[model samples]
Target: MKEYSVTPNKNAEGWYVKIEDVAPTDLYSKKDDAIAEAEKLASNDTPSRLMILDENHEIVEEKKY
Candidate 1:
């Protein structure tokens, strides 16, 4: 299974949607935008998981597809 995650940037000024073990390709200014992109990626890749993290880098929500 693959995994995707939405996490705040180091500066907490942007969000990133990343695939497990891979570098993020883009930065989103809004958390919701990052989450939406991650969810779409996870759902398209069945048997994948999406994790949403807060500014503190703690997992706040998770979804399996």
Candidate 2:
């Protein structure tokens, strides 16, 4: 299964959508945007998981596709 995550940047300036074991390619200014993108990616990649983290890097929500 594949996995994707949406986390706040270290500085809290933006959000990052990251694939498991891969570096993020884009940073979204809004957390919602990041989550939306991650969800789309996860849905497209069936048998995937989407993890959403808060500013403190704690997993807040998890969804499986």
Clashing pairs in 1: none
Q: Estimate each model's TM-score.
A: 0.94, 0.94
List per-prediction Cα lDDT, in the order shown.
0.91, 0.91
Task: Write candidate 1's Cα lDDT for 1-65 as tens digits.
Answer: 99999998999999999999489957999988888899899999999999899889899999999
lDDT of 2 at 60: 93
Off by over 4 Å in 2: none
Model 1 alpha-carbon drift over 4 Å, by segment: none
Candidate 2 clash figure, as a count: 0
- Candidate 1 shows a clash count of 0
